[model samples]
Target: MRKAVSVLLAILLAVTGCAGPAERQDLAHVSYLTSFNTFGRDAYVYVAQEKGFFASRGIDVEITPGTGSVDVLKLVAAGRADFGVADFTATAITLAKERLPVTTIAAIHQKSLAAIVTLEGSGISKPADMVGRKIGDQPGSTNQVMFPVYAKAAGIDAGKVEFVPSAPPALPQLLAAGQVDGIGQFVVGTPLIEAAAKGRKAVVLPYGDLVPDLYGNALVVSKEFQGKAPDKVRSFTDALLEGLEYAITHPDEVGPILKKYQPTQDATVASAEVALMAPYVRPSGYSGRVGGMTEERVEKIIRTLVEARAIPDGVVLRPGDLATFG
Candidate 1:
């Protein structure tokens, strides 16, 4: 009788495709850092959380707001955060300059959105106009870090332009108050900045217009995490990108979703930011797979940085050294 019962239990287990309770209950917990506050630009992580995308991949993600891309990169390198979303150019420069143990697992935006934004009557309609003017921004933000390169490309003397340090939330207000001539911001930030300006038109000088080859934000992970759990890294990246695709496609829905996580964020402004960001996420005529990148393009970016004096010429880097492709 006992042997018959044992055989029956074994048969039932096989039929049900059961695994050990421990194996079934185990889930990887990770902390994810966004490049900035809970703006629409960083809403996809919330989308992933709300849609159960991370949970479906056996991950429990704690999404935290980062101060800036450069700060996010530093935190990820220090292993304070398991993963981070940051600008590709900032990460590349840091990797070449400091050899931080970080790698980009996926590309978010195909083009750089960095820009110098100014209000009407600021007399800063063009890059050259920025010379001898004050530009306010977070000290280490992508826009501030890359300003010199943008200035050089636009035939402006970078040294003459003064960069005023301020918190991210204060920048738009600073510009509106006429405390600064311009602010370093991304192109998608137009709606929010314009709203702050209270009827003033924003004159945006986009960095991508002059430096076309540069890529934007990306998913970065520390080498330690990548080595310890490569499969988890891939799973997390897949889930995050899935959320990004959905967020960009459903901007209206994403606005409410971001508002749910960040009550301070205005849903309408969030929606507008996502709408403006859609074209950069999937550029026109780009047939490649989503989040996919190539070595040739990365190499070109490095060379561009070198030529622009963003990185030391003596420091050598390759795509494989900074990112994992395929």
Candidate 2:
């Protein structure tokens, strides 16, 4: 009986040994900042975390909520966060205006989300309809700042529109109350604005209609961090893109995932927003792999900004200086 038991033990040990030990995982901890508050659009990070994509890549990511894209870019440039999601146009404008030690690693939304939003039946249907109308404008929002450029592309007189200065939160309320005809806003904010308007439908005229080449959000990292840990940067980008793909494909699941991380976020609204943003994230006719950008397209974007005077005249900004999906 003793010999038989010994043989059984040896067999069990052999079976276990054949599988070998688990792969050595040395996790690298990193911080990631979203472009804005814990909205549904930003829920992809949570999805990535829940799916173990980061873990599989030997990364432990800490997610933080950001105020806005410009603010997120500043924090990332200052090394306050290892990586951040921000608007590519905002990044380019800021870079042109002031030198920051940051570079975009991947493109998230291929087109700008900026738009002039209003409630349906406001009698504003097109860009030309905005002339002589009152638009609630947030002081430094990208939508407001780029209005003149949009105005030019749409062939509307910028001076004709009346821009009413208002705080970001007040704009939606102002629009809902019939205090303003329109508001400078992002198309993604439709769900929230419609909620604020008490079920009133939103009419969005996306700037992408005229500014077709403009990019929306991008994955950013400080130049210092990228220089020091290129491999980690690549791994993190891959995992994040994977999460984005999953979130877009399964938008209904994103709401619950976002609610898990941000209890204040409305799950229904979050899901709706993800569904709305999916098209912009992976627009039709874009042949490159997800998160990829070409130098020629980047140059076209720069030229568009320059032509619109969004970027200062004669300010040299090469594609390589702004982004490299390498």
Candidate 3:
């Protein structure tokens, strides 16, 4: 869904974005892993920096840009990182099956962000219309599982949509070239819409558009850190929330912040990204809200994973065992 644009931005942006004044708690040093591009999860860290939330709490935070889902999870489980931002499926499956020593602290994107995108003129308005169309998706990805479940339920045969390996950036090209009829994208919709609005004509089909709820972004702290630096983890979460809350309300400020943090971003591109992320900001009491989680949502994902064989048969997950939203 996200690619590493500039890792240096990850550190500087969060460390200096807008951290606010809080009582000096403890001078703690922590390394965290994240892969949600410069503007997604990375932006949350930047918001913390901008708000001065981290410093007020006396925490020295270092942010590292991770490559993909596997790399991010491995960084946390291997103890190379005290904490990480990752997906619920990868975290839960690893814990249930591989028994890795990592636990999620929060679910950032309460709603699934993955989507099947198409051009506006493609006349493919519904998921079922994707049948018999060439749909691009990263091979052997979490989305591969997600797409099939969605397509099947939509009455679109999974085998009917030709699956291909392609990332979000590649989708526009493949789509414009008419090489593929649609793409299952992970990043939010504005990028595709803007890409189309600017002439690409992409149509984004968010999973929530039809598919059942599937978890997206999340923050995870290692077992070592959980036992030793619970305060640190909690402080990080609080600082992160500071940023997230700002991003949710004052999205206009993000462009300049992106310019300062991720200077490489073009205004047009960043503007599109800003719009793309808007929908992800759930209502105060809905979706992945501040300190939000539901057993029903988790079970929906767990059952989906188990049904897909991502976890072993007969596996059941407990709330307190896998997540801690509060």
TM-score of each: 0.91, 0.85, 0.76
Per-residue CA lDDT of candidate 3, range 1-326, in tens? 13464676787777665453222324577787665445443566776777788877877777776654556777788899887776666567667766667777776666666677788788798877877778776553445546655665566667777888776345556776778887756665446444644775566777756644676767887777788878878888888767767775666676677667677645455545545565554633564456466777786777766665556777666656677645
Q: Choose the strongest candidate by lDDT.
A: 1
Per-candidate Cα lDDT values, in order, are 0.89, 0.86, 0.66
Q: On residues 215-326, what C-alpha lDDT tens digit does candidate 1 reach at each position?
A: 9898999999999999999999999999999988999998899999999999999999989998899999988766878899999998888889988878888889889888
Q: What are the RMSDs of all candidates, in order? A: 5.4, 5.4, 10.2
Could you tell me the TM-score of candidate 2? 0.85
Candidate 1 error regions (>4 Å): 1-25
lDDT of 2 by residue, 154-260 (tens): 99889899988787657778999999999988798899899989989999999998888888889999999999999999999999999999999999999998898
Model 1, residue 311: C-alpha shift (Å) = 1.1
What would the TM-score be for candidate 3 when compared with the true structure? 0.76
Worst 10 residues of 2 by lDDT: 18-27
Candidates arranged by TM-score, highest first: 1, 2, 3
